[model samples]
Every structure is written in C-alpha cells, then in structure tokens.
Target: MGDLGRQLAYWDGAGAAKTFTHPVEHEWLAGVSRAARVLDYGCGYGRVMASLADHGFTELAGVDLAPALVARGRALRPDLAFDVLTDPPAVPRPDGSYDLVLLFAVLTCVPSAAAQRELIAETARLLAPGGLLYVSDLLLQEDERNRARYAAYADAHGTPYGVFETSDGAVCRHHSIDELRSLLGGFELVRERRVEVATMNGHGAQGVQLLVRAR
Candidate 1:
C-alpha cells in the first residue's frame, strides 16, 4: 500500500470505462446462506454484487479505493452499498464482521507483494472464523506477448517478474500459483478452478479462482 498515488489517479480517471470479466461461480456459493453478510473488496461499480443479488444472495456490501468508481457503482446499483476507501488495507468495520469476502481481480491492480499481503491480511481480519474468501485473479501467462511485457517491465522498473505496466497508464501484476498459496497461508483451500477471463482491456487471459475457508 505504499505510494498508491499513481494507481489511484489512474482508476479515478479511467476506471469507469473498464469492465471486469472475472466469472463468479454461483455453484461454489450454493451452500452459503442467503442471509450471510458478504463484502466485495475492490468492487468496481458493483457488477459482481449485483450478480450475487440476482442469484438471491442478500446482505452484500462493496468497498473500493477509487471515488469515481464507487460513485458510478452507487449510481448503477442504488440498492447495493458501495463505500470509497480513503485509507485502504483497512476496511472500517468490526473484526469478523463479514461471513464472506470477495477479492475479484483485485490483486492485479496492486503491483507490490507487500501491498498484496497487507490487503489479504485485512480481508482475513474482516472475516469470521471459518468464513469464506473467494479470489478471482490473473495467473502468469506463458504466451510470448505476455512474457515480453513481463520482461520489459521487470527490466525497466525492477518490479516482480509478472508485474507489468499497461498502455493505459496503470501498473498491474499477474501471480504464480505458488505465490498465491503463500499469500493465503492462513486459509484452507476449499475449492479451486482455472478459467479464461477477459482483461479490463478485453484481452483473453488465464485466471484462477479460489474458494478458501479461514483456518
């Protein structure tokens, strides 16, 4: 969460035009109670929250760092709750406030490993014991195009191997499976699946979705 000024500016400026394509597996959530309190971290414009509501899941709230994105979410989904996160990695709520936490395509936007760890820790703090954490995010790509970008950015900025900068002035990261497992060390894996997803720029990409329960 260090010096997120640039990322914040990018999202506040162009976030409204971006579309998140991470698929929410309703089947995975089938066992969850309809009344369970759910929190959608990095919920841009409430898209996933709306989908959850449509599938009969009630008591959902979303929080995002971008003001414009949160504003747009409130406008689009008036019934859902969306809050702007002025102090990130710290959602203002009591400990164990939520039964489920959604981390949809959020890690990519956070380029630093330390920041990602802090975010995950915050998510864990917000969840009740044995609560679920659903994560949908990009996996490192083997294709030449992605490889080249990864190398270029790593060489130029000295960021991690899978971290890269987009043409749209935003820095993002794709994670390895091992890295993700290390990040979620406190959680026990419940279910996992590999899926194809569209990037905000509409490019086809490989992604992993995980449903884990707090230990």
Candidate 2:
C-alpha cells in the first residue's frame, strides 16, 4: 500500500463511523462563524468536519488523500462535500479562498520535512489574508525505549530526528516546539497549547496544538 492507502488502512482499524471531540478544539471553534468557509485538510472520515457541523458551522468541506476515507466521509455526510485527492500534496482550492484551514494531525504522518514545509506553503497559499490555520501534531515525547528506537531508526536510515516508523510500518514524525515554529514561519503565531493525549490511530504521545493566521 502507498502512504495514502496505508493511512486508510490505519484508520480502518479504528472503524469507519467515528467522531472525535476535544475541549481545546471546541473552544477554538466557538469563535468561528457559521458563514465562514472552512476546509478540513487531511480530514479522515470527516470527523472534525462533522464536529464543526454539529457546532453549526456551515459551508464546510473536507479533502483527504485516502480514497476510502473520503468515501466513508461521503457516506456519513452526503450533504457536506468531501473530496478525494488523486494528487498527493495538492489541494484543489484556489488561492485566498478559505477562511479557515485545519491541519490537525496531518504533519506527523508526513515523514519528510521538506514535504511538510511545502504543504504548509500550499496551505498558506490557500488562505485568505486574515484566514486562520489551525494545527495539532505530535510533540517530541518518547519514553526511554521509544527514544532509543527512534534514535536507531534515524541512525540506520539517516532520517531526520523525530522521524520513525510506527508499529503499523507507517512513517511519522514528532516535532519539537522550535521545529514547529520554524516550519510554520510563513504564518503569524496566534496561540499554541500543549495537549497530552494519545492519537486515535493507537500511538500514544503528547501533542502540540497551534493556531496561526496567514501572514
């Protein structure tokens, strides 16, 4: 399976129709108007988008690289738009179109730092002048054994620090705060908070959530 396929497989184990909620994410969403155009980039099965809709967010759309996830999302919310991207790293949105672009848990799955930076640039391009970019990702937190495993992977393959393979054989990266800041330099920092929770994909780690505006 390709990266997208692997991601679909990973989420498949978690079930097709599942919804996730976060207190911090909900608090942030409280300020968003229902009329705002929102794009949930990397939206797996439209969980967050559904949550936004529940919070009365209209004009919401979602895009995912995994076709299966997109299909599932469509099945769950046929009234809402859900697109499957055939092209990797390409969002089929015009420049300065969206008021909010969410990148929750996306960067971690992208193992290459260069690709991550490029994706951020694309996201910036898609945002309106005052648009918001919300990001939540895995923070660099590893136990002793996990740290050694990450180190061994980096040493063996010369991968970047924090880049390692998950138990499912999928590659993911954990980011330090400084690294996150540098990668997100194209945007103006609004707010950032640390969330200590394991991901739904079965990986247990701390995460950092960021809210930024288009520069």
Candidate 3:
C-alpha cells in the first residue's frame, strides 16, 4: 500500500467522519452559484459533498485516494459522484471542467513536495477559467510538542520541518503560508485568511484556510 492507502486504511478503521467545518469554508462556498459544478478533491465520506448539496449546489462530485472512504461516501450520498484513484493520483475529469474544486485538508497528507505540486497543478487543470480553488490545511504552528516531533523527523529522515507523524500513526505536512503560496503559483490568490480548525490527524493542531482563483 502507498502512503495514502495506508492512511486510508487507518481512516477506515478509525471511522472517517468529518464532524467539523471551518467558518472560512462556509464563507468561500457561499460564492458558488447553485448551478456551478463542484469537485471535492480528497473528499472523505462525502461529508462536504452532502453539505454542498444542502447548500443547494446542483452538480456535485468527489474523488478520494481511499477506497473505503470512497465506498463510504458512495453509500452515504448515492446521488453525488465518487471515485477512488489508482496507485498514481488521477482525478478522471475533463480539463477545465469544474467551477469549484475543493482541496480541504489534502496537501497535508502528502509527504512529497513534488507530489503536492503535481496535485495542485492537476487541480488547476480541472478548473475552468475564473473557477475557484479552496484549500484548508495545517499551518506550521509554535506548539512545543509538534515542534519537537517535527524536529525528530528532521533529525531521523533529514526531511523538512513541516512533515511529521501524528498520534494516530499517520504522517502529515504542516505548510508555511509562504510555501503554500509559492506552490500554488499557477492560481491567482483572491482571498486568504488564517482560521483555527480541528486537526484531521489525531494530533490536535491549529490550521490555515486559503481561497484562490484559477488564473
């Protein structure tokens, strides 16, 4: 199993249910028109997809790296579209297709900077002109425990400070705002705000949310 596959297995065994939502997500999603086609990348268990449906979005779909999560999402929201990616990452959508693409809490899971860049580039390719890309991820905070953990990873693997292991045996990346902005250079940043949200990994840490537009 790949890193994401292992993490997905952990989520499946641990009950992958998203119970929290950041206020920034609501604020950004409010801009999506009712007829807009939305794609929720890394959407686990269709929680956000269902929420979008409730918000009156007519066209909704999601893709996940975890089969169990995708199955759970399909079971939960049969009306919404769901697909599980193969070994290599693929979204299975036409280029410039969606009006909105969500990348909530996804980049943090990917350990490779190259993989993260490729994912972001693929997301950009999926968006139509003037489409929106919404991202929320763990921010590199000043917490002593997390800092110590990150340092240990750096010492052991010679990796960067942002990648660390969570209490639930899952690895995640905590990106600096500058790093995120540089990686998302293809998109035009329309709005960005730091929001404190619950941690997806078992380790509880503060997070940052970003909203951008495809250029």
Candidate 4:
C-alpha cells in the first residue's frame, strides 16, 4: 500500500477506533463553551469529528496530510465535508478565525522539530481571541520501545511519506512533552496530561496531552 494505507491501518487497528477516544477529553474541550468553528487538523478517519458531531458540535472541519486518507475519510462519512492539507496549514486562517482548532496527535508526525514549530505557529495564528488549541501526541522518552509501532510504520512507508530520521531507516521523530510545549508559545498552557503508557500496550490510547490557549 502507501502512506494512506499505513494511516488507515493504524486508525482502524484493533481497539483504537472504538476504545481509545475519551469523552472526558471532549467534555473538557466543550468546557470552552464558546467554541464554534473547530478544525480537526490531521484528521485521519474523522473519528473525533464524528464524536464531536454526535455531541452537537456540527460546525466542524477536518484536514489531513494525505489525500488518499482524506478520500477514504470521505468514503467513511459520505455526508460530511473534508478539506485540503488540513485547515490553516499552508496559508493559515486569519487571526482568531476559528474558536477552536483540534491538533490532536499531529505534532509528532513531522520529521524535524522545526516543522512542528511551524505547524504550531500556524495553529496559533488560526485561533481566535479566547480561542483554544488542543494538541496530543507521543512524547519522546528514554525508552525507545515506546514508539515501536510508529517505527514499524516508518519502515513500511518512509520514502513515500517523505519522512526523515527513521530509527531503522524509517521516518520518525518522537518528541518529549517538553518539546511539545516549546512548539506553542503564543498560547498559554492551561492544562496538560499524559494519556497512555507504552508499557501498557497503550499505543491505542494516543499519548494524550491537551493544551488550551485561552483567548
């Protein structure tokens, strides 16, 4: 297959699509109350959007790096709308353009930490005054095994995805939580938490870390 196949395999992997999503996380996000325009950056199969939509958050959008994945996402939800390169990606939205931008699990994908910073800056630019940005991803740690699954993925599709620094000749860059913080400077961090432990075979748990930048 290809990059899209790799992503789809991961998303549709056992227990991830069904058991990984946490309502408390969504409820916590909903606490922002004023959130109207939400951009699900790097949305894979639209699972989070589907959940948010189920909770009455209809003003939703999704963006992904892979066109094949986006195409598949459309097939998964024929009634919903999908967009290009994820929202606010290249030419980001106007300042305070959206009330909330969901960037969950997006930061860790890029090969370089610098790219992560650029992505974060764009995300910050898209936030409205009092708008919030939510992000979650695997944190780099001493244990190399933590990102084994991603490593495997990289080995399978590194060249096609255009990724660099593969642990085993694959595309991968695991960031620690502190590195994540460095990426989002404009927005004040209100809260943070680690959602999974690789030791627990919790890759499906998403290594969740939520940061909200208050307007």
Candidate 5:
C-alpha cells in the first residue's frame, strides 16, 4: 500500500490548487428526498455539497483528509458543514448516520487498494441500510500516454497497474471496472454512467459515475 502520510502531505500542500471537475448528476439524485442526511466524503472545497444545497437538500456535511482543503471548503461554502478528517478510513460520525454518501474522485487520490477498500467500508458503516452511495472516479485509460505512465509508475514504485504519480507529485490511481465493483460489493448497483471529465490537472479522461444502494 502507498504511504498514507505522503499522500496526506501532498494534499495538505499542493492540493489546495486542485480544481475537482467531477459532475454530480442531479437526475441520479432526483429520487432522494430533500431532507435526506447527506455526507460528502473526501469532499474537497465542498463543490458537490454546494450543488446539493442549491437543489434543496437541507442536510449536508463534507469531510476531507487534508486540513487545507477542508479549510478552503469551509470558506467557499460557509452555509454547509465542512471538517478535516482526523482519522483515515474512519469517519467521526456514528454508524448509519447518513442517508446518502458521496465519494467523488476520492478513490483516485488513494493509490492503495487496501486503503480504498477501508474507505468504502467506512462509507458503508456511515450509511443507513438502503441509503445511496454516489461515486465518481477515473477509469483506466487505453491511451498510450496513460498506459505508459501506469506501466512505468507501477514498475518503479511496486504499486498496482493503474497507480501513477501526477506531475505535481501527488500519487493517484485509476481503476478497472471489476476492481471498482469488488470494492462496492456490499451495495446493490442502482445506476451507472460513463462520462468524460477533466482531471484535476485539466486533462480530459474517461470517468464513471455510479449510484448504489447500501445492502
């Protein structure tokens, strides 16, 4: 597994400049009640939470591992709640505390499979039974540039096939469809969609959006 300390350090520093571009599909969330308790896990700058609040979601909270990012989020959306996650893979909230959880672009930031699974397990713990988990993340790209980077980085760092280092020094990982589904095994897939989104560094990439119900 990649060192969590290094990852956190990168985000605490250079991550402040990153602009998350994952689009939160309002249609996918239309069925959810406005009163539903929503938690945006790994929410950098509270962009998704702000969008949800604009759409009438009354209960919303966001948390991120990077203190700087969480501080930026609080400044950007003072009306919504934002907190720095003091513990990794374990949210401070009680089990079943949320009716919905958003995991946007978070899996990519976490380069270790075990850490990603632990994060998902925590998401499940936070969600009430039958609650929804909305995830948006990068998929392994077939392009030569990406393939070469993935191969080189994996070879150099002894990480997984899709793991790579960003130009700005952050470690990130893309996921295979099977790998992602395996991580969400505790949930029943409700809907999925493929879309092109700009990377935090502003490169176009293939990404997947998923809505799953907690079992």
Candidate 6:
C-alpha cells in the first residue's frame, strides 16, 4: 500500500504522465454507451467520471476507498456525486440496480486476490442483467509470449514493483492475469485487450482492459 501511494504520487503528482484520466475507453466501454446508472468504482480525483459526465453520461457517481483523494475528487468536479469508503462496501447500490460498473486501474491496487473476488462478486450483485463492467490495469501476463506487464518494465528500469499485500490478510501477492480471472469467476467475459503501454517509476508495461457482462 505504501508503494502504491508512492506510485500515485509519482504518476498523478506534479509533473507526470497524464491527468488522473487514464484511458478507460477500452473496448469494454465502447460497447456500452447506453448504460444509465454508472458507478466509477475506485474513482480518484474524478477525472475519468468527470470526463464521462462531460461526454453526457449524466447519471454518474464516483467512489473511492481513500477519503483524502475522494475529497479532492469532489473538489475537482463539484457537479458529480462522490462517495468515500475507507474499505469499500459490497455494492454501492441495490442488487441488479446499476447498468454499468467501472473499476479503472483499481484492481491492481487491491491488497489481495480475495479482495478482488469480493469486488467482483459485489459488482456482479449490483449489476443489472445485461449490465456491463469495465476493468483495466497492468497485470502480469500468464503467457510470457509478450513482455507487456509492469514486472517486465520493472526488470528493465531496475525499479521493483509488485503486489506486496492482500486485502484479506497476509502479505505479498503479485498481481497476474490468472489472479484476475480467478476473481471474475461468475462474469461472462465479452472482450479483453491491451489498451496502452504505461511506464511508471521508470518501469513500463502493457495495460490490459476488460469488458464483461453480468450473468
């Protein structure tokens, strides 16, 4: 968690790659523009959800686990609704209520695989049938066919980066594609694709994005 804080400081801090508006417009978002009740889970500084609102996604709400960042997000985009959860609840809304759920660059920050599953299950519970959930992040690829994860860039830049903790308990769980897959056991995967190449803290890797539908 400390490492992630430092990374956030590096990336979203003073002079970094881009705004908090990371490219969440992957293939998953492209397919579901009509969704009304959208929740930007793990929202930070509200750039992405603000952008979505700017694009006419009116029914939007942003939630994050960090209170300080959530306050900053509310300040940045006063028009949008913002909620802060020290530890995120199961679902932000009632079951089968949300038309869309977005966890952009959030899962990797999670402490563990069990937390990931809890997030996935909660999202599933909140999603209305045919509702869509969009997830994007830099994950350790199972197949070494491509050197496109943070670890590869970490190896190149000589900077160390990995999941050093899990949300449930214990310590150190390096995030991988398989772990994410295991987390999303109930969702039906619609598509998965690499969105961009991210180099953080002198380390670079491929960013993968996902679009899934509720079962």
Over the stretch 1-215, how does candidate 5's per-residue lDDT look in tens digits? Answer: 24444587888888886899899899998999999999999888999999999999999999888899988988888899988877777788899999999999999988888788888988999999999999999999999999999999988989999999889998899999888888888899999999899999999999998899999
- What local distance difference test score does each model get? 0.92, 0.78, 0.79, 0.60, 0.90, 0.63
lDDT of 5 at 203: 96
- TM-score per prediction, in order, is 0.97, 0.88, 0.89, 0.71, 0.97, 0.72
Candidate 5 weakest ten by summed lDDT: 1-10
Give candidate 6 regions above 4 Å deviation. 1-21, 26-35, 141-162, 165-174, 197-202
Best by lDDT: 1
- Residue clash pairs of candidate 3: none
RMSD of each: 1.0, 2.9, 2.3, 6.4, 1.3, 6.7
Tell me the lDDT of candidate 6. Answer: 0.63
Task: Spell out the clash pairs found in candidate 4.
Answer: 63-86, 96-128, 130-215, 140-175, 140-176, 166-170
Q: Model 2, 145-195: lDDT tens per residue?
A: 568767988998898888877665567788889999999887899888988
User: lDDT by residue for model 6 over 1-215, one digit each (tens)?
Assistant: 23323334332343222334348563345555644899888787787787788676778988765666767777778898988654454544678878988887776565444556667778888889988888877665344433343355456544335543222221222356666666665788888776555522333455777787888
> What is candidate 6's CA lDDT for residue 143?
47
Q: Give one clash count per candidate, in the order shown.
A: 0, 0, 0, 6, 0, 6
- Rank candidates, lDDT, best first: 1, 5, 3, 2, 6, 4
Q: Tell me how far the alpha carbon of residue 147 in candidate 4 is from the true structure, in angstroms, after superposition.
A: 8.7
RMSD of 2: 2.9
Q: Model 2 TM-score?
A: 0.88
